[model samples]
Target: MKHEDMVKSLSERVPLLKKEWLGIYRRMGEHPHAPKWNTLCGDRLFEADLESVRSFEGKLQKERLNFRELPPESIILWCSEMERRSQWFESVLNGIDIKNDWCRITPMTRRDMQSKLEQIVPLDADLSRLVVNPTSGTTGHPIPAPNHPAAVGCYDPLIQYALRMNGLNTDCSGDKVAAIQICSQQKTIVYHTVHSYLEGAGFAKINLEQNCWRTDESSAFYINDMHPVFLSGDPYSFLDYINRGIEYRPESILSTAISMEKIVRDKLHGYFRCPVVDMYSLNETGPIAYSCPHDPSKFHILPNDIFVEVLSGTGEPVPEGERGEIAVTGGRNPYLPLLRYLTGDTASMNYGECSCGEISPAIVNLGGRKLVLFYGKSGKIVNSIDISGIIRSFPVYTFSFIQRSDYRCTLKIAAGGELTSRSAKFMKEKIESLFDNEIKVEIESENILLKEKTMPFICELEL
Candidate 1:
C-alpha cells in the first residue's frame, strides 16, 4: 500500500491500533528482558501514527528551510500556530475562562505535577489506557508520571529530528541501535528486540557489569558482530566501555541521561571517529533538544513537540542570552500534559541563526538541577558535576556520595580493579580543595550496588 493510504487506513482504525499496541506492551512487560524490550517497542511506536508523524516531520523540515526567509510577521504567525496546537494549554485556558492571556495561568514545577498528576492530565483523557512511568529522580526525588501510547510514540519523530540534525539520513532501513546501561534485577542482563518502523532493523540493550558479561572482550565481540548503527548509553556506562577497551566503532554515539564532559566526548570521538550527539531530555517530557551538528554546545529545541521558555527567578521571561530556569510547555504526552513546568535546570537562550540552519530556539550552557548542589563551609555551594568529574577520572567500578552533614560527606566507591593509596590520596585532596578544606571527606572502598534508579548524589543533611 502507498504511504498515504496506509496512514489513512491506520487513522480510521485508531481504536484497534491502540488495543494492539497495548497488548504488545503488556506482553513485552512480562518478558524476562522487559525493560529493554518495552523501550524498543515504545521507540518504534512513535512512528506508528504515520500521518501525524509525517505532518510533524514536514513542519520541522519547513521551519528549518524557511528560517532565514521568514520575516518578523511570518515568525509571529508561526509561533501563534504552534500555540494553537497545544491542546493541554488550550484546555487550561478554557477551564480558567482566560482568552488571549496565556501568561495569566501560573507556571507549574516538578513538585506540582508529582502531587497533582490527575489535575494536570486532560479532563477527557482515558486514564485506564495510559501507562505509568516513574522519573529516574536524577535531579530530585523520584515520582510516578502518567504516559499514553501516543506520547511514547512521539519519540519516533523527536529521535528522527535528532538524527537529521546530526547529518544522518532519516531513511534508516536495516539500521540497528545498541543501548548499554544498567537494568533492573528482574530483567535479563542482555537482550534484543526488533524495531517496528523499519524492516530488519534491531535494538539491543546490554548491561556491561561484571555480573552481566564475564569480560570486556566477550562483550566487544558480541557488539562488533551486531554492528549497530549507533551506540547509546549514560556517561558512566560509556566511560566503562572506553576503560574496558571495547573497540567497536559505530556510525554515531548518543550520550543521554547525564551530561558529557568535553574530555570524555573528545576521547570517544578519537576512538570511534563518529559524531557524539549529546541528547537533552527528561522522562516526563521525552526528547526536548539535541546538540547541533555544527556546534555541540548549542542545543536546538524540538519546537514541534515542546515549547521552551527561559524564565527568571520571579517567573518572568528573561532576555535572550541570560541564564534562567527552563520552563517547558506543550509536550506530546497526553496523559501528563504540562504548562510552563519549571524543569529545575538552568540554561541561557540564543536566538541567533545556527550554522546548521536549524532556526529553532537554542539553549546554551545547559546545566543540571540546582538540587544537586551541596552546601560547603562559609556558604559555598559545591556542584555535584565537579565532584563526579574528579571521581570519574579514577578507575572506579561505580561510586556514590552521601552528604551526612553540612561539613561531612561519605564516599562509597566500588573499585574496578585496585584502589591504590596514591589514587585515594589524590581524590581526597581534590574533593577537600573544592570545599575549602573545611569539609571532612571520608572515602570508603566497598561494593556499592549500582541499581537502575540509583542517584549519584544523596543529601541527608537536614535543611
Candidate 2:
C-alpha cells in the first residue's frame, strides 16, 4: 500500500515519468508505453482518401497475409515478454501467481466495469498492473480491458514513430490538442468548440475538435501564438479556408477521428502542403497500426505490442486474402486484456509481398461495419465504397443517403453548422451528379446521431 501511494503521488507530480514508477512497484500494470505515448498523443482527427488508406480494392480481393509465417514456438517467448510489459494481461490470459488484490481483480464485462473505471485507474497509478480494463465494445457490446502499463512502454513509442512517418513534430511542437467527438468520464459531446476542453492548463498544440472552428481573432491567437500542429480537419476546412478567413498551416497531417474522403485528403495535402497520412484506430483502442510510407498497400501492426487475427464470422481464422472479422489478442492497455476479442469490423491480410517491404503482415481490406452503397435510378445497384467515393466530397462528414424510392434520394446529415444558401447549393449539386436528373437531396442534417455531437465518420443509412 505504501508503494502504491508513493507511485500514485509521484505520477501526479511528474506526469511524464508515470510508467517508470509503476514498473518499480510490487504489483505490475499494463498499457505499455502509455504515459509516454499519452503525452505525445492528444490530437484531433479527420478521414482520408481511397475509402482505404494503404490497400487497393483490387489487391485486397486477390491477396491476404498468412499467420503461418509467424513461428509457432513464439507464443511462449511472447508470453514472457508480455508479462514484463503487461502483467495484468499475463495474469489474466496466462496463469500468474496473483494471490493478492494487487493483481487478482476479477475482470469485468463492459457493463460491470464502468463504475470501477477510475477507481482502478488512478491518475497517479502509472504501470503497476492496476489499469482500468477498457472494453473493445465489438460484440455490439463491450469487453472489459484492464489497464496495462508495460504495454504502453512499447505502444507509446510506436505512436511517436508513426507520427514521424508523417513528418510531424520534428522541431515545432505545441501543447493544445483537439477532438471532433470527445468521450470523457461524462457523456459524448460534439467537441466543436476549441475552448470547451481548454481550461487553465492547455497543451502546446491545438486539438481541433470537429464542429465549427471559431473564425474570431481568438482563433488567430491559437494560430499565431499557440501555433498548434493541425491534427485533422474536413476537406471543406482544409480547402476552403479562404472562405473561412484564416490561412494557418499545421506542422503535420494526423487523419482519422472522423472520415475524410480521398477528395478531401487531396485538398488537405494541398492545404498543409505536407505528407498527410491516416491511421487505423478507435477511441477504445489507441493507434493500433500505421501506413508505412514505402508501402501504401498494407498496414503494419505494432506487432511488438499487439496481436491481431482476421477471423470469419464463425470465429474461424480466415486465410490470407479472405475477408474476416478482426480479432485483437494483445492491447496496449492491460486494463483491457482483449484476448480473442472480436472487433465488429471486417478486414483481410496481404498475401502478396508489399512494395514497401516490411516483413510485418500487411492488413488489407478492413470491410466490416460498412453501409452498402446502392445507386442507379431504381436504386437497383450496389455501389459500396467504390461508387460512394464521390459522396464523400461534401464538407459535412456525418451523413446517410438512401434511395428506396426510384428517382428521389433522402440525404440525412448530422446537424452542426446551419446550411447557408452557398452550403445548401453545394449539397444539392453533389447529390444530383450521383443520381442524376431524378436525384433529390434532402439535407435532414438531423435524424441520425447529432453530427455536432459526434465524431462518427460516415453513418451510412443502413441498407
Candidate 3:
C-alpha cells in the first residue's frame, strides 16, 4: 500500500494524523525513488518542496515507490544519491534571483510576515503544489507558514534516512529497545524505531518536566530487560541526565528539536559517552537539516527537496561567509510551500566544499530562532542552550531559565535524584556571570513540573 492509502486508513481510525499530515504523501509516489510518507517533521530534518506535488498523482509519479514499506537497499541507494545531489543542488540554488520567476520564488519581510502570512501565500495560485506551513523556535514564537505539502512529506523520510545513516535503524525488527522522548508527556511521536503506535519495543517514557533526570536501580528496573539502543531527548532534558549523571548509558544518544551549545553538547556527549546529533527543522516547514556524525559543526540540508538562502535583514542576499537570516523553501509537502520564508534562525552562508564530499548547502553555527537576546552592550544575543549549558554544568535534576528583563533572569530547577540547595547555588553563579549587568536569579525547586506548564528551553516570540 502507498503512504497516502496507509495515512487515509489510519486517519479514519486516528483522526489526529489527519491534522498532522499535510497531504504530501499522495504525491510522493510520483517519482521512481520514494519512501513511505508517514507524517511531517517537527524538530527533525529539512523537508523541501517537491515540484510535482500540486496534484496528488503528480507527487507520486515523482517518487514512483510505495513508502509504506521501505527496503533497506532503497534507503541505502537514496543516501548515495543524496550525497551526489547535495552538491548539484547547492550550485543551482545559490544563483536564484527573485527577479526571475516569482512563481518559483518570493520573499517576505519578517515584520509583515508574522502579521500577514496567510494573505501572502496565494501570490502564486498556479503554484498550488507548494503548500503552507509554520515554524517556531526558542523566542521567535511562530512565523506564518505558506508552503507546499510536498516539502513537508519530504521531511519524514529524510529524517528516518538520516537516522539510519547514523548507524541506527528505525525499523529494528526482533531487537527490543527503548527511547526517551521529551516531545510530550506520553512521548508518543513514533518517528524512531521504538516510538511506535503498535509495540513500544519495551520502551519506558519519562517527561522531562517530571524531573526524572537520573537513572537508578529502580529506573533501570523499567528498562533492564531490553538493552536500549539509544536515549533521545532535547539538550535541556539530556543535561538533566548529565547533571545527575545517567546510571545506564545507551550505545547511542540523540538530541534534537532544540538548540545545544558546544559546551553543553560536549558535556552531554561525555556524560552519555556518545555523539550528540543535532536536527534543524521547524514545526510548520518540517525537518530541513541534520548534523552528520562525520561533520558536527555543519548540518547537511535535505537537498533538491529543501532549497535554502541566506539573506540579510533587508531582504537582500548576503555574501558567503557572512552572518544572515536563513530562509528556506521547496519540498514534497502539498499542504504548504514556504516561499522565501524568513526563518528567524541566523547562520553563516557556506558555499565551500565539505570534507564529507556532500555538495548541498550546509549551515554552520545555527543560532536558533533569535532566542539569544542581544543586549545592546555588544549586541550579543544569548542563545537558549547557552543558559541551559550553565545550569547543566551543575548537579540540577531539571532546569528552565526565563528571560525576565534585559539583565534579570529566573532559573527554575526541578529536584530529582539527589539534587539539593548546594547544586542550585552552583547553577545560579554559573549562569549569572553570563550576563555582564545586574542579573536577578531566582531558583524555584519544583518536585515535578506539571505537563501543560512544561516550558521547553525556548519559546517563540509572541506577536
Candidate 4:
C-alpha cells in the first residue's frame, strides 16, 4: 500500500499508534516487501485488555485449585449464551443439560467444524469484525477459522506471560523491533508493522528463503539490522535460521506450529544461549499452552478463559492423570466460541500442584503433532507444514505421507469422495514436485488412513 493509505489503515486499526513510531513505520515501508497489519484492536480497548492480562498473570503466579470438568465461572454463562445464539449448540442441547450432565453432550470434533461451521458460530457474533485464518497445522485438513482483531491482538500479553515464566523479562518497546516471526517456506509473505500493544515496538514476518532477499547475505544482514529482542517460528524454520548462520543473538525463541523434539530444543538453546519454549497452539484456538520452564514434559495452559479436558475414545471425560484426546472449551476469539472442541491431539491432564508453581492444569505426555522433515533432490530440507499445505488441497478426509529411507514417498489418502486415477496421479505429481521430482511417489487410496490417531507426516531418511 502507498504511504498515505498505509497511514490511514494503521490509524484505523491502531488509533493509538504513537507519533514517534512513524519513523520506524516509514522505515518498514522501505524494506524489500510491502507491510500488512491485519489485526489490531480498533480502539484503546487493548489497553484495558493488557491490564486484565497483567492481573491474570498475578493470579497465575500463585497456587490455586485446578478445576475439574469445566472452569466453574465461564461454563454456565457461556453455555446459556451458546444455546440461545448458536444453532449447533441449540440442536445439540435440545434436551440435554450441559450444566448438570455435561458428559452427555457430544464433544465437538474437527469434522463438525469442517462441515458445519456456519451453524456452530453464534448468531449474535459480529460478522463485520470477523477475519478468517486458514489452517492445516494438524490432521491435513484445512479449516478456516473466524477471528476478531481484538482477540488476535490479545496474544501479545499472553506471549509476554510465557516469556516471564521462562525467566526472560523482555522490553519490546520504543524504537527497537520487538520480534520477528521467521519462516523457511518456498513461498510465504514477508512484512513488517508496528504494534500498538507493544508500545510501537516493530514486528516482522520474513521468509529465510534465498529469493526473499536481493543477495544470499542480505537475509542475515536484514535480521541483524532489525535486532529483534526475540524470535518466533516452528522448529524447521529455527533450524533453517541457524543453518543460514545469522549472528544476531535473541533473548529467547518461541517454537510453535508443531511439537519440538528434545534434541531440537536442546540444540536451539545451546546455539543461541536462550530458552527455547515449545508452545502448543492452533490457528483455530489461538494460543493454548506453553512448555513449562521447570518441566519440559509439561505444558501449562495459557489463557484463563479456556477449560481443558481429556476425553477417552468413547468421548467420556477420563479420570484425572489419564491419557486421552485433548479437548478445549471457551476462548477469547469472539467469532469462534468453541464448546468441548476435540483438538485431535492426545495428552494426559495433570491437576495436582506442579513443580513450576502454576496452579493452572498442565497437559503431560502431549502427543500426535510432531516436527517431521523431508529432503528435496538438491538436498534442500522440506518442512511437514509445507507438505501439508500441498496435500490439503486434495479431496481427502485425511492423509499419511511417508518418506522411506530410499527417499521414495507413499501417500495414503482416505478419500473425501470417490478416488479417481487422474486426481491420484495429480496428487502423486504434486508430492514429487515437492521433492524436486527426485523421489518416486505412490498414491494409494485407503479406507482409513488414520487408526487411533493421525500421523500425517513421517520420514525415515537419515540426515
Candidate 5:
C-alpha cells in the first residue's frame, strides 16, 4: 500500500490518529538506513475498541488483582458466550458441567490449534477482522494462532501495567518512539508502523543482523536515534543488543517469547541502568504475566479476564502452590476463545499479596514450554527440566542443548567469561551423568547463543 493509503486505512480503522505523530511515523519510514520492510502491518483497531482496551487497563490499575478461582464465574459466562457464538465451543463444551472446573473437559493443546483452528474459531467471528499470527514455536509445534487487531492492541496496556508494577512507566508523547520490538534472528519480518492506541507514537519491529541494515553500524545508529520509550524483545535479542554496543537507553525493557535467566536479566539491568522486565507471553495468548519487581523468580498475572490454573497430567487441578502444567481460560481475543488451554508451561500458583504491592497470585518457578526429552547413549530418556536445573546451578548466561541421533550431545553456553574452567568442567560432568554416562557432553563457552536463533533444547534421536 502507498504511504498515503496506509495512513488512510489506519485513519479509517482508528479515527483518533493524531496529526503531530505523523512526522515521527514518516521519519521512521524515510530514514536513510531504514530496514527493507517485508510488509506493511498496523494495529487494525477501531477507536471504540482502543477505548475498551484503555478501560481494561484502567481497571487493571484500579483493581487489587486477586487469584483466579479454579473456574471463575466470569469464565462460566465467557464459555456460555463462546458456546452461543462459536460452533467449536458448542460442540466441545456441549454437555460439560463448567461450573465445577475444567477437569472433565479435555484441555485444548497446540495440536487442536494447529489442525482444528477453523472449528476453534467462533462462528460469529468476523473473518475480515481476524489476523493469522504465526508463532515461532520454540516448543517445536508452531501454529498460526487466530488473533484480532483490538486483541493485539491490548498488549501495550499490559506492558504499561508491567512497567507500573516495576515503578517505571512507558507511556510517552506522540513525538517520541513508543516501542521497538527487536529481533536478532536470521529471518524475521521487519517493519515500522504506528499504533493508534499509542496515539500514533511510532513502533518498529527491526532485526539487528547486519544484513538488515545499510551498514554494520547503521543498526546501532538508527536505534540510538529512535530512542524508543521501551524495548521489547526476547532474551537472545536483548543479549545481541548488548553485544552490539548500542548506547541508547529507554525507560524499561520487556523481554518476552521465552524465559530469561536471572543472570541475563541482571546483566541487562546493570548495563541499561533500567528495569529489565521478564514478560511471560505467547502469540496465542498475548502477555500472560510479567516478572515481579521484587523477585525475578515469580510472575504476576497481567489480564483480569483470564483465569490461570495449574493442572496435573491427568487434567486435574493440583493443590494450591504445587507445581503443574499452567492452563489458562478466558481471554479478550474475539477470534480465539481459550477454554482450559494447556499452555505447555509449568509453574506453581501462589495467592495473596506480593512485595510489589500487587494482590494477585504470582506464578512461581515458571518453566518454559512442555517437557522435552532427549535420548541418552544407553537409550534412556532425559528430561529437559533436569538439564535446566543443572544449568541453573552455574553462572550461565544463555545456553543451548542439542542431541543427535547417534546419542552425541553438545551444550553451547554463553556466560560472558563468568564460568571458570573448573566450573565448566563440573557442569559438563553433571550433564553427562544425566545421560547415564553414555553421551559425551561438549561445551562451547562462547557468545554464540546470543548471535543466532538457538533452541534451548533439541532432540534428533527417533523416539
Candidate 6:
C-alpha cells in the first residue's frame, strides 16, 4: 500500500480506538488494571495498521541480512560525495560573481538558517517534495528544517552503523520498537511506522505520566507483553520508567533529546542489562554521533553525512581534546544545508582511533545547553536530569524551577489556564520529597513561554 493510503486508514481507525479505550477505562472504574487497557488498546490499534506492520517486517529482514561496512576511508569518500551533490555547497564555492574558496564563507548557525531558510536551499532544489521538520524548541526557539525524502532515507544506514559498532545485530526478525516521547494532550499515541530499511518493525509512542497510565505496574506489564526488541526515549521518560520498576528488557535502548549523565546511564545499564546507546542527534541535523558501547564517553561521529568541528568562542578551532562549541558542516538535509553550523553544544574531540577500530573522530566529554546547578542538603550539586522527571509529571503547558538557594526555590508554571490548587499541591509535595524537605518549595502560576534556549531549572544561588 502507498504511504498515503496507509496513513488514511490509520487516521480513520485512531479515533475509533480512542473512543473504545475511553469506554473501557470508564467501565473498569478504579480497578488496578484499568490503565493497562490503554496499552493493550494501543497495541491492537497498531496491529490493525497492517500495511505499516508488513513494511517494517520487510525492512527488518533487509537490515539483518545486509550490513554496510563503513570504515574511515569510506566515510571520507562519502563526505566528498555529499558536497558534490549539495546545491548549497556549489553556490558557496561559486561566490556572488567569482569562484570563492569554501573557507571564505562563514559557518551558519541555527539562527542563521532560521532567518534565511530559503536562501540556503539549493538553487535547483524542489521544495514541493521535501518535508518540513520543526525543531522541538528545547534549546531556545524552534526552527523549521527541510529535508528531501532521500536525505531522510539516510537514517537507516547510520542507525545500522551504530548498531554494528556496538556488536548488536540489526536483524530482530519479529521484535517491535517502543518509543516513548511527549504527546500533546494524549496519554499515548500508538501507531505502526516503518523505516525504509527496517520495514515491519512494530512502533509505538507512549507518554510517561500518570495521565498516560493508571499505575507503573500496568505500564510495565503492557511493555513485557508487547516484547519490544528495541526501546527508545528521552532521558526523563526513561528515568521515570526505571523508577516505576519496569524490568522488561529489550535488545537495545536508545537515549536521545538531552545529554545522558553518568548516574542515569549507570542506572539504565544496571537495570536493563542491555546496551544503552546514547544518540547525539538534532532536528536540524539527524544522527550526529552515537555512543560506543565499549566506551560510552567516546561518541563516534557520523562522518558520512555530518562533518564536526569544535571551535572556541572566537570561531577558531580549539586545540584537540579541548572543550568548545560544536560546529557542523555537510549534511544530507538539502533544504537546510548546514555550513559549519554552531550547534549549541560543548564537547572535546579526540583524533586518536577508538579501541573499536573505527578511525572516525570521536566527541568526548559531551555537554548540553548549560543549566544552573541546584544544591542539595549536603551541598551536593543536582543535575538538570535529576529534577526533569519530577517536573514532567505535571500536565502543564510549560514550567520552570528557579533555585534561589540551597534551602529555598520557586516553581513557576504556565498551564494555559489557572492551575488548580490540588495539582499545585501535588507538584509541591513531589518536589519537597525529592529534596528531602530540606528545601522550601513555592509554586506560582505564571504567564511564561518556555524557550528552547532557556534551562527549565535555573539556580540563582551563588556558590
Index of the highest-lDDT prediction: 5
lDDT of each: 0.62, 0.42, 0.48, 0.77, 0.77, 0.59
Most TM-score-accurate candidate: 4
TM-score of 2: 0.49
Quote model 4's TM-score.
Answer: 0.88
lDDT of 6 by residue, 279-372 (tens): 8888788888889777998887763545677877776667778998888776666577676688878898777567886666788898864434
Could you tell me which 10 consecutive residues in candidate 4 have the lowest summed lDDT?
A: 34-43
Worst 10 residues of 2 by lDDT: 180-189
In order of lDDT, best first, we have 5, 4, 1, 6, 3, 2
Comparison by lDDT, 4 against 5, better one: 5
Per-model TM-score on C-alpha atoms:
0.66, 0.49, 0.52, 0.88, 0.78, 0.64
- The C-alpha stretches of model 4 lying farther than 4 A from their native spots are 9-18, 29-65, 393-396, 414-430, 445-452
Off by over 4 Å in 5: 1-16, 369-456, 459-463
Which segments of candidate 6 are over 4 A away from where they belong?
1-103, 173-190, 214-216, 369-463
lDDT of 3 by residue, 80-197 (tens): 3332344322232344433343223335444434445444333334563443442223432333455544444444345444465455645532225534343321112222222222
Model 1's C-alpha root-mean-square deviation from the true structure amounts to 12.3
lDDT tens digits by residue: candidate 4, 1-463: 6868877877776666768887876665565533232333233335665565455555545523367755566666787778898998898878986778788778887778867889888888879767765564555655667887677776787787788788778677778888888888766656677887677878888788777777788778777877788899988889989998988879989988878888988889988898888888888888888889998778988877788899998878898789999988887787677888898899998776678767788898999488888897579677777777777666666778899988888887777665577887887887677778888888878775455365788899887
Encode model 5's per-residue lDDT on 202-307: one tens digit a residue.
8999988778888888888888888888889877788779988988888889887768877888899998899888888877888888889998789988888888
Tell me the spans in candidate 1 whose CA falls farther than 4 Å from its real position: 1-51, 63-100, 175-190, 214-216, 369-463
Cα RMSD for predicted model 4: 3.7
**Best of the two (3, 6) by lDDT:** 6
C-alpha RMSD by candidate, in order? 12.3, 15.5, 15.4, 3.7, 11.3, 9.3
